[model samples]
Target: MVERKTIFSYLPHLILLIGIAVVAFPVYVAFVASTWDPATISNGQMPLRPGPHFLENYYQTIFVGTSRTTREPVGGMMFNSLVMALTIAIGKIAISIISAFAIVYFRFPFRMTAFWVIFVTLMLPVEVRIYPTYKIVSDLGLLDSYAGLTIPLIASATATLLFRQFFMTVPDELVEASKIDGAGPMQFFRDTLLPLSITSIAALFVIQFIYGWNQYLWPLLITTRDSMQTIVIGIKKMIVTQDALTEWQIAMATAVLAMLPPVLVVILMQRLFVKGLVETEK
Candidate 1:
């Protein structure tokens, strides 16, 4: 027999649709603004629908650098952001997983102490430690570089704790079986743990990638050159304090472009990301 629906059953779907509309409306407006000319947007004459200048505004935003606030093209900024995001995501995963594996598998002195230390770092985020971290990075000549943008932010104590928790849930029988099959620590990790951790990795990668992409304060402090700016920073720079001088259409286009990468990442990894979050048993 088919299950019957009720008014209550439809409430959640209705709520979700409302939430989607609330979130998407601004983005839709931004896209429309991006397609219009600066005068239309500035004079508040922009229509809800897209304009014919989509190609011109986007081409100028992407390739031909903006006129007033930032002289660097959005393309270069996007590249900088992509590099920083990928490096941070991959670096955090590699470091956290290895740290978690050692803390879980190997029996060493202060093992729990080490794990607690890592966990404690969750309380001391980058903002809390920005001063000393910036000093070190500056002294090391990493300012205005990709390393400066990512290294200080890549440790990810939260990811380490997550991996540690996941590793603990793994059955000891699997470890014994791996040993019996002539697999060493590295071999077992490489062949077994890595495969098992794929979903978790994807989940963390998405989180960290967005974290890196949206970074503004740290990148702002470190990067002095226009060429080294990320897309988020580029958006900020494009909208000058002087309203007339600011290229509204170009800024809106840049804003729309800035959102594309992270959105694409989440879309592509939606499956693994959801699995990693909700999956409990191995």
Candidate 2:
């Protein structure tokens, strides 16, 4: 209480409150809208108050979906999203950590050259290489499969860079000590590096999970099969009519449902995520 006496101290809280409102307001509106039917919202006179059909609307959206479009269950879409998010999160961590370790610990021919080549990928967003990615996946016959859905998006230049930089900050004494104890690189990596990297790994998992969950474009592009469609893409199908006929209530419900897992992940890993950001930079 004493620390918060000054107006300066309250300024940060005020700013944060404003930021929270800015972010939460849309979600709140969606929740409100999801509780109402089309006729109630279509007149452009929707109430901020909760409507009576909230449970029914959500039940239909999750289990039955819309009769007008898609009609695929939201439960299935959620499951697909979960699988893709987990796959991408785990895959990126595995790929990035190994790449980071090799780049940091070993001395080989064109080592820095390889690092630079990997780093250069950060300059090229997926949109730029979408065609090439599609071609490769198609040639490999992975389209519409889980591998096709996730493998293409699993590469993360930023994650590799973070791990590599963090690895550099690790004391060389640990490496020497391990070698003196007759521990090989793999042994040291498994025993020491992984233990030390729990925070970083948790933080990356939180981030990459959200990234994978919110992926609309790549999933939409690759997954032609309704059964493989992720929640984010499934939401788009609700608006197929694009007018008042578009079931805003179900769409809003779907949006709210889609937000849950990532929100829960961030909330649970909040401390580790912040710590990882600060530590990895140092």
Please report, in order, the local distance difference test score of every candidate based on alpha carbons: 0.88, 0.89
Off by over 4 Å in 1: 1-16, 275-282
Mind giving the per-residue lDDT tens digits that candidate 2 earns over 60-130?
A: 99999987888898999999999999999999999999999999999999999989998898888889888
Would you estimate the TM-scores of all the predictions? 0.91, 0.90
Go through the candidates in order and give the clash count of each: 0, 0
Residue 224 displacement (Å), model 2 = 0.8
Candidate 2 residue 47 C-alpha distance from true site, Å: 1.4
| Residue 259 in model 1: lDDT | 97
The all-Cα superposition gives candidate 2 an RMSD in Å to the true structure of 2.9
